[model samples]
Target: MLVDIRVQEEGFSLDAELARLAGVGLDVGGIGLFMGLVRGDGGLAALVLEHYPGMTESMIARIVAQAGTRFGLLACTVIHRVGRLPVGAPIVLVLCAAAHRGAALEATEFVIDWLKTQAPFWKREEFPDGQGRWVAARESDEAAAARWGMDGPTES
Candidate 1:
């Protein structure tokens, strides 16, 4: 299986990523994707994300590995951006390819759900007033992961 995981401050091209996944040549019948964007809700100015370099990548790789094993994925890619990002900017991308549509879709969903609840990424919401606050995990996000038999994030 091909697993590409990256944590960078630069933006990614969806076109390039899709093309790369398709070119893996594994008789893949479907590719599932999820792109998360920074929302501008409630007059939010921007979002700043931070992660613990090598540790963060390792955790994400483990999550991706679990998804591949569970769904028999042919290939998977995860790209997450850090640093301050303007509203409407892409934050994360999860792509999963499989021999069947169901496996590909399910693996994509599983990886994203785990990432939301388990990934060691911290986010701070900045406002136009020059104020920023650390964002906490939402109960809805915990519930979503729980649906997949995963536990909620523990307080650090």
Candidate 2:
């Protein structure tokens, strides 16, 4: 499996990224992709994401490796953006290519779900009223991660 993990402040071009996957020379029958965007709800102005640079990448790398072991993945790419982002801006992207649709889809979901709950990124939402608050983890995210039935790297 070929795993590519990137944590950057610049926005990404989906087409460009997908093209790189196509060039991998693998017989990928299906490609699953998920793009997460900043929501405009709750009078939000923007979201600020901060992370411990080296640690964040390492954590995501482990998640990708786990997905590769669990699924028959031909290639996988994960891109997560940090810094301030406006509403409607893309924040994260996950792509998985596999021999069958099921593996690609499941691996894509697994990577994103794990990243949400396990990645060491802190988020702060800036409101239109000039107030900012740290974002909290939601039970839904934890539940989603738990459904995978695989213990995360830091889980005791």
Candidate 3:
């Protein structure tokens, strides 16, 4: 299956995915999910996320497809939100279903971990101190992508 991608201002719901993949092909013994939300820390608010629409989606799609090839996942989902979001709101969601709990969990982790470091989105954080800043691209995030065992996000 192709990787799912969504870049929107509204929150994403995970329940429907759970229902669809549960006990589906391969008798998915388990499913693991992780969702990230906006934090109260000024670190995220200081900057807005800007994207190159078609390019952004294509990049995420390639990464997700690569994850599916590497992991034995029955299904996987990735949804990310962009725009002026309030604190504590959902930012990203990842869900994975597989024949075993371990694979399901690992696949879930891989999706989010890679997204954090490799996705093309640029985030600018707004500080409470009134000084907004762009998040310096994290070596950690790049490192995270490296650990995924893929060369990295595919070039455009």
The 10-residue segment with the lowest total lDDT in model 2: 147-156
lDDT of 1 by residue, 23-130 (tens): 998598999999999999989999999998887888888889888888999999999999999999999999999999999999999989989878889999999999
Model 1 spans with C-alpha error above 4 angstroms: 150-156
How far out, in Å, is residue 53 in model 3?
0.7
- Each candidate's TM vs. the true structure? 0.94, 0.95, 0.83
- Local distance difference test scores for all models: 0.91, 0.91, 0.72
Question: For each candidate, C-alpha RMSD in Å?
Answer: 2.5, 1.3, 2.5
lDDT of 3 by residue, 1-156 (tens): 434578887776567766766736767788788988767763544346676788767777777777677677767777888876666777788877777888878878887877776677877777666667676887887787677666675754
Q: Enumerate residue pairs that collide in model 3.
A: 45-126, 46-125, 46-126, 47-124, 47-125, 47-126
User: What 10-residue stretch in candidate 1 is worst by lDDT?
Assistant: 147-156
Model 2 C-alpha lDDT per residue in residues 1-156, reported as the tens digit of each score:
888899999999999999987777668888899999999999999999999889889899888888888897889999999999999999999999988899999999999999998899999999988899999889999999999886884453
**Ranking of models by TM-score:** 2, 1, 3
Q: In model 1, what is the error at residue 90, expressed in angstroms?
A: 0.2
